[model samples]
Target: MTPTAVDASIQRVARFGATERRLHTIHASAFVVMFLTGLVLYVPTLAQVFSNRPVVKGIHLVAAAAWLTALALVAVLGDRRALRRTRREIERFDADDLRWLRRRTPSPQGRLNAGQKVHAILQAALALLFTVSGTLLWLSERNTDLRLPGTIALHDWSMILAGVLVAGHVWIALSPDKLPALRGILRGTVPAGWAASHHPKWQAPPAGSAQRAPRAGPVRLVAAAVVVASGLLVTAAFTGLAFT
Candidate 1:
């Protein structure tokens, strides 16, 4: 069936719960802030515009902590069933997914296609690398005489890798075919037809039971606000330290 036809036959489906959506928002926001602040600190030309190294470093660290915390919280409290399903799909790619990757077949995917799964896996690994190298870098700052030989290089290279992966991720996400998935992230629902066409194996919730609206509970809002405020406070405090 054509994508449009498939979508037209299905009802609006809820793909993400409120907690999952909140975690995603927090993670994405923190990554953007970290990427920007890290870029400014790393590039000489960019650093010239914002010469407060301490403040920039502080922002980067705070963003990293927030992003890691969001990931941890999602792991602990997000949809367990969805997480398990995604993990299984990622671990064993279906034949159709491989064929799709090789351009030998045209078929809809399950909850996540092979490409998406691979991306998630790589990003997760990179996050770990960044965390370790970054911690070493921070410690080296306090004890220069005990600095590890390759700690700085590892951290620098990991940042470069992350930038490249994120660029590809953004490009793919913005492509026409992936727009529906992007909309699902923002709205927590996609037209049944679109879901069926893109993710054929995905089972929809029972009729009349789909959550068509995005949840913006007060607690979620407050938590997000606190994260942003904490990032700002970290930046200000470090900037003050630089002046002292």
Candidate 2:
């Protein structure tokens, strides 16, 4: 079903602003191009159809790299605060999220539903997969004189999987009834009517409409720091392995 009409007056937070929204749009567009190009480049039969196989491969590689970098910056770093807020706002398989999914409750202006939570988590996971695997592939190719042990097969399959997941991600993102979600990304605010109709729970009293901001608890902060350090350590280990 198409998205229910949202009012045009909800005050969206300046969460992603204009530049960030533009980045999001670029990332989304590049993802589609990269996936299609990668598919054509991977299959020998398809590659042979085009006389300029090298050119196509180059385009695919550049597009994927650009999309991956942009996603890491925009969705991961730039939206960390927004993600935390979204998680808090939609914690668990709450009655709210379920209601929205079932069409029992209308969508909230700023509140993301269960489907959105799933999409967000999956997109983050896919980004990590692409980055790590792409790095390994690059290092392996750059210094073939120094052996990087691991199956070329593994790298190829990982790339294929990432491409497939990205395509699926795009399909889900573009599904009908996601206009508010799209608009939220574009304008950074849902209309006031949308806010009331969709997420009455988040609506603050007129006297004190300032809702509490989502703050990363100490535990979450520590956990994220650990993950970052671990990623660095892993990359360093791989580089060391390549040299040795």
Candidate 3:
């Protein structure tokens, strides 16, 4: 085969497996829950706009905390595997993909465009902000001695911004042309053709076969289990073990 034909064939081999898709779906769902719950909790004025203010607020706060825990687990525990896979795909972006991503015209594969990449990074950063702000808010409200200036303001504003950003993320997720990307999340399987079109280099192998530096084992798992169990116990102390 000629050099150009060989390059084309090489590009067709990269694809993400069902595992990554499952992770992405879980992340997306968790973020959506966190965002909506945060909205209901933070915007008391919306109580007038919507009904059952206090109940909604409670639900929102609880969901946001749960999602935060879940996301933290995903990041700390799953990052090693996820980052490796995403990097392989992202690194393979060539001039054509870049141009297609930036162009006004729609793409055939509708892979995550450049905007999605930026938003993903921003979402990660915002998750950090939510963690810090939330902890501070919780502390300030509980302890009389712990005085944090702008704690209330920061929490409120950060949540508001996160809400807006999440809306954008959802819009992108629901975009008409990106059905395949959405399906990848829901069905936990991107067809081989879909992966070939979107991520040319991710088709490296059938996942789990990639060799990389050894990572810490099950530390994140134990940590997550402890945290979730503790949080549940504490919550049960007041709310009767409401797992919802």
Candidate 4:
């Protein structure tokens, strides 16, 4: 191959940008805070060892709030083009992805593979569930009419599920083969060879070439509408429940 062709083939690719890196950092820090505080609050041994229930609970609540706020800010201020690209990558599961999942073929993925996409969606849903349930549990502290036991049950169960998922996520992220992906999130780029091997479908732009900013498409508009509608519906239902 010619020098130009080789240069094109081995060019470094942008994986995560500044905004994505910041968001991931915020989420990771919040998760660590919440998880540690939660363990202290939930575990009998840790509770005794900590011997400061209120402080632990306070820290957990603050972490939860921070996590939620970070997510809200990202939704409001993050680049829509980047978000759309990520969503499309995560949502698309072709035959290659399936074959890779089944171990029937080598990894033929784009920016995100099936496992990462599934994990991202599941974690997002779990975070939402945890937030709702935690809020209900908090409200139950002041309102006797609110079903405390049910809220507690929901919150506890959600936390347990989230904890398990987080453990798996950590295991995968820290694994030897996946460490480069973690580094990409931290540094906003990965080696061209690594990208080429693991994500064969990802086409890296030529070295030092600028990537064009994508415009908002119909799919993005529809997705935003759906999210807004869902948020409204959920808020209305919660308000009704609170009043009645």
Candidate 5:
């Protein structure tokens, strides 16, 4: 129960629900796939080595679509209250968050720090730019003289910024002090002591709720499927508009 006891056997607290874990999994996996495929498409040496531009491009596009779909899926099917709360948490920044960002203080922090919020914002913005730019780039192949200057520039710059964020995120997650959080994301819980120290501001689920225990069960699968399908339908409509 001691804060210094970082072992797995220590008492656990519910840091993430199954929905959050699913969303995180999909986002991380999709991003990795897109990043790798994008690199292959962008690097001349890698392109030559692969000698299959179409395949690489195809994979990247698929990963991007999947990423978007997964987010929408979670939004529609996940716990609305929890999702809304998380959104507010990410958007809310106060003096405490500022101090945390400046490394001035560690206590009185919420589940997410200022840097994490900034990371989320930058990630969402970059993803939007990448998708829009990528769509145009893809369409150009089929439409002669449709090539638009600066499209590639936007996409490339987005990739560069994403790479930077991903690098920093990795470094932070691997640090000794942050390993508990990393495990929390992977397992959907962290030591109660760790939570008490790092995220003292974190709100535990209400009393009499079974959330304190390790509960990794997912949301309803059928419901999640419906949500994912709806998301795809919406994406299709937008894609239709883009093509027009």
Candidate 6:
């Protein structure tokens, strides 16, 4: 009674639920506003063209607030179970995930490949840094004591790193091979065949046929976590100097 290949190719599988899409939509929309406004604020040449610096600055602040608000709203109203599961998936990496990073041909070990997981981690960390540094910079304008040299550099560097990641993400999403994934995120479903080919580990299983996949050693994982945390702490300490 197994389905034929043709049947699988045309079958639609749920790739992302409604809550996920909504969160992504809000995040993306806010990011666009922030990035564009940030460009004007960061680039001297663009700032010259846009003479109304006050308005631009206001818009940039508003966008940053919206970004923070979006996360809060999602936390209060979004599917808690789904969000938790996604967080777990993005945080853990298995042997397949490690291989996925070095050899691109093989299917990722899960719904999110290793690279995607890494990108998600970086984005979250950078977003936190951006918020912290941006807030300090905004307040520093009024309270000279809050002014910190490292704060501005952290904010600007975060934006640059995030920009590069976003660019690569967009390029991959737009590529023909990856278009199905992009469409899945947008529409919440994808051809089962495509999912099978791209993420075999996540192929829609028959009812009551689910099982857990094996994971890799935790040494590297712990080391990576410590490295990221150390970097963040160093930057945080450097930025906090102005306040102290």
Query: Considering every candidate listed, which one attains the maximal TM-score?
Result: 5
- What lDDT, from 0 to 1, does candidate 3 have? 0.56
CA shift of 123, model 4, Å: 0.5
User: Which candidate order results from sorting by TM-score in descending order?
Assistant: 5, 6, 4, 1, 3, 2
* Reference-based TM-score of each model: 0.76, 0.56, 0.64, 0.77, 0.79, 0.79
Please state every model's RMSD to the true fold in angstroms: 5.2, 8.4, 6.5, 6.8, 5.4, 10.2
Clashing pairs in 1: 6-193, 7-193
lDDT of 3 by residue, 170-223 (tens): 787788766766655564334455566555434234323323334547876687
Model 3 TM-score relative to the real fold: 0.64
Residue lDDT tens for model 6, 1-244: 2213332337666667666787788878888888898899899999999978777776677666656655655555556577888899998988898878878657456777798899889888988998899989877876899998899889989999989999998998899999888877887766666777777787564322222222324754464455556545544443344233
Task: Give the lDDT of residue 123 in candidate 5.
Answer: 83
Misplaced by over 4 Å in model 2 are 1-23, 68-110, 144-176, 191-244
91-141 in candidate 2: lDDT tens per residue?
566666676778845554344557656666666666666566656665566
The local distance difference test score of model 4 is: 0.71
lDDT of 5 by residue, 102-146 (tens): 885654877787888899888878878987898788668767576
Give residue 204's error in model 1 in angstroms: 2.9
Which ten-residue region of model 2 has the weakest summed lDDT?
Answer: 203-212
Candidate 5 off by > 4 Å: 1-9, 143-146, 206-244
Residue 125's C-alpha lDDT in candidate 1?
A: 86
lDDT of 1 by residue, 39-135 (tens): 8988999999998877787678766766765665555445556666656767877788888788837666776777887887887787788888876
Clashes of each: 2, 10, 3, 0, 0, 0
